[model samples]
Target: MKIPKIIHQIWSGIDGPLPQEFRSLGETWKRDYPDWEYRLWDNKKMVEFVKNEYPEYWFVYQKYPFNVQRWDAIRYLILEKIGGMYVDFDYESLQPMCEILENKTCCFSLEKEVGSNLFKVFNNAMMMSTPNHPFMQKIVKFVFSRTTLIPQYTNKNLTIFNTTGPYALIRLYETLTTEEKEDVYLIPAQFVSPFTGLEAEEVRLGVVNQKLDDCLDNAYAVHYYVSNWVKTNN
Candidate 1:
């Protein structure tokens, strides 16, 4: 069955913390799929609509010390409450991601096993899942319930709450059966080129042509890792 395409976007603000990496991702949705019904979450009406329509979706404020991690928590809420495909601000798409769903409930990215602190980094940038999915529900629960006390380890580079959300989900994803995992497509490199270190010849080949221009053409979305791009332009 062909999956119905429903695209969504959220802008915190022009000078909001996400910067261009986030807006760039949103721009891709507008540019790549003109037919897509895009929605921004910052407006009061839209925020109310999402909450009223799907109360299961809950968002937390970036209060005091928690300011740094609120964005991640907001994403968790949207994915669970709205229950469709959602992308983070940093994610960029090279093609129509809707074609990949085939109507399946959820999709997400997988970073090759990388460990930082206890939290493993999974591709939370682009996630597709339904509210009814058991696995996804479990993840939403885990994220919401956890208390994110800053870690005491100052020498360490990573923190638990910072990466724990994505890491836990990725770890869980790894354990799924082949058939189970198939329900969630692992969007190949060509489609979701995460701007991680690219020392490998193959990765360079895939993304190196005409570089930014080529990226703009093929990418339905691009996860801009750099914040300056957004701050300077928008």
Candidate 2:
């Protein structure tokens, strides 16, 4: 049987370094769930989409924007155009993402509390779905729609973006139905990310047992935060 394919998007400029990322992803898949496939999507599509859809917003990307809100919007727009999950280059997939978000229209890491400024702030680092998912479409469109007006208020760079918390909360609130909103799974702050210094133990546990069947066996991916791949045997 052919393994199901999962999509991963990155910038076109990183083509040379893509091999290392592919190797990392491949190793994790082989070690954990060998029956999965990963596909790469680059910045070309996003660039075109941004130009055609929101020409005035093009310069923002040139400034090297780090805001998750805007990045997440681009990711979902691209995902909607093609179909599948979009992951950040810095992320390492310890397991197939589908394992965690199975049958769900869309899923992204979530912060535990409202005031947390941690990584779960923006769903940008990782996002999952098949295609044309209603909620995901709504959230992406809302973010993109606001892009045109962003420059009117602030310059190309804004601190509001470095933390995706407030925007994510608002996006979730806007897109989900009352029940979906209330019952949406946060995927346990640790399962999704270990952004706090206090979460070191949790990351150690994941590193110690980097297998699909171990630590949050139901999780689909592991972010690892670090850009390079390394493993220490326990």
Candidate 3:
């Protein structure tokens, strides 16, 4: 079956209006794929939906930091429940998604490596899946298991990352058997994130004067790494 042409984004009401950069990104997608559905979920709506559908996780969802941390949980839940593409607001579409979504049950992007520790880490910033794909189901199960073992009041950054962010997703992906791995499509970093978190600063400053590399010639989208800037500035 063809993957549904639905794109999802989250912007809690507290975040205020969408910035011009994000607005431009949304416009780009709309212009490129007018037939696709663009669905935006705010904090209130997301909370209500989770409460009704996954009551076991509602407490953990409510307890997570209201910032981007909660999105770690929200993205998986939304995708598992409805089955579609979830793109971070920080990303821009360089090409249409029709080619990427064609005949794929699920797909994830590789993070640009920062060091030996982060090499080959898969990023959840942009993910596409059919509803209730096993990988997503495992992610939800991972969240529930972690929440039980770790106290929610802990405010440590690393703790939050491990619990709901790429750290957790990476850990789960590693445990899958070879046969299970066949179900997932992994996009190389060059396609989804040609720039690492460190290089994002250079992109922001306009210091890197170069054209897109051949590796990105067929990239479907580019994650601008705005979240890295937000965390750094904080």
Candidate 4:
């Protein structure tokens, strides 16, 4: 079955409107898929909607120290309630989303490794799913379970990654049965995020030179790793 042609993005109003850097990228997706619906959710609207519809999560959601965690939570909620595609604001589209969603009930991006590791990690930065897909429901439950038993951590990085980033998603995904995994598709890093977090700085500096074109050549969308900017500015 074809996934619904809806695109969702979340941003805190505190940041003002979508940054100019990402505007053309977003517009490109719209131009390529005129029939698709684009939905942008800001912080205030996200909180109000979550409070009314998912009251169980409101208490924990409000307690998150970083806006990124809240943003992560709401993306799962939105995708669970209304099946569609969720792309990070920092991503630039290189192709129509329909081609990616075709013949898939759910999809996730496999993140590029920043260091030596035996296992692959999937990113939550971009996801597509049909409404009420089991994978999304599982994520909602996982988030609630973590929030209810908040743990003490040494640093912000660990807390953030464990709470709402790719690490948490990877942990939950591992628990799924073989049958449940069949409906999900994992797109390679080359197709969504060719750069690892460590290499993201080069993209920001525009120092990649010729390698830039090669990295993006096979990607449907390139994730600019803008979250790295958040850490630096803070």
Candidate 1, number of clashes: 16
* Model 4, CA-based lDDT: 0.79
- Please give the TM-score that candidate 1 achieves against the real structure: 0.64
Which of candidates 1 and 4 reaches a greater lDDT?
4
Best by lDDT: 4
TM-scores for all candidates? 0.64, 0.59, 0.87, 0.90
- What would the per-residue lDDT of candidate 4 be over residues 58-147, giving only the tens digit for each residue? 877887776677888899999898888898877877777566667998899888766786776887889998989999999888876645
* Residue 3, model 4, lDDT: 80
Residue pairs with colliding backbones in model 4 are: none
Candidate 3 least-lDDT 10 residues: 225-234
Question: Would you give me the overall lDDT of model 1?
Answer: 0.53
Index of the highest-TM-score prediction: 4
What are the root-mean-square deviations of the candidates from the true structure over C-alphas? 6.2, 7.4, 2.9, 2.3
Error of 2 at 185 (Å): 4.2
- Per-residue lDDT over 1-234 for candidate 3, one digit per residue giving the tens place of the 0 to 100 score: 466688898877664778888888777776777888989898888888888999988777766544556667888999999988898877877778676567889889887676675445877889989998999999988876645345554555666577877888888888999889888888777777877775665666676455534435767777777773245311
Clashes of 3: 0
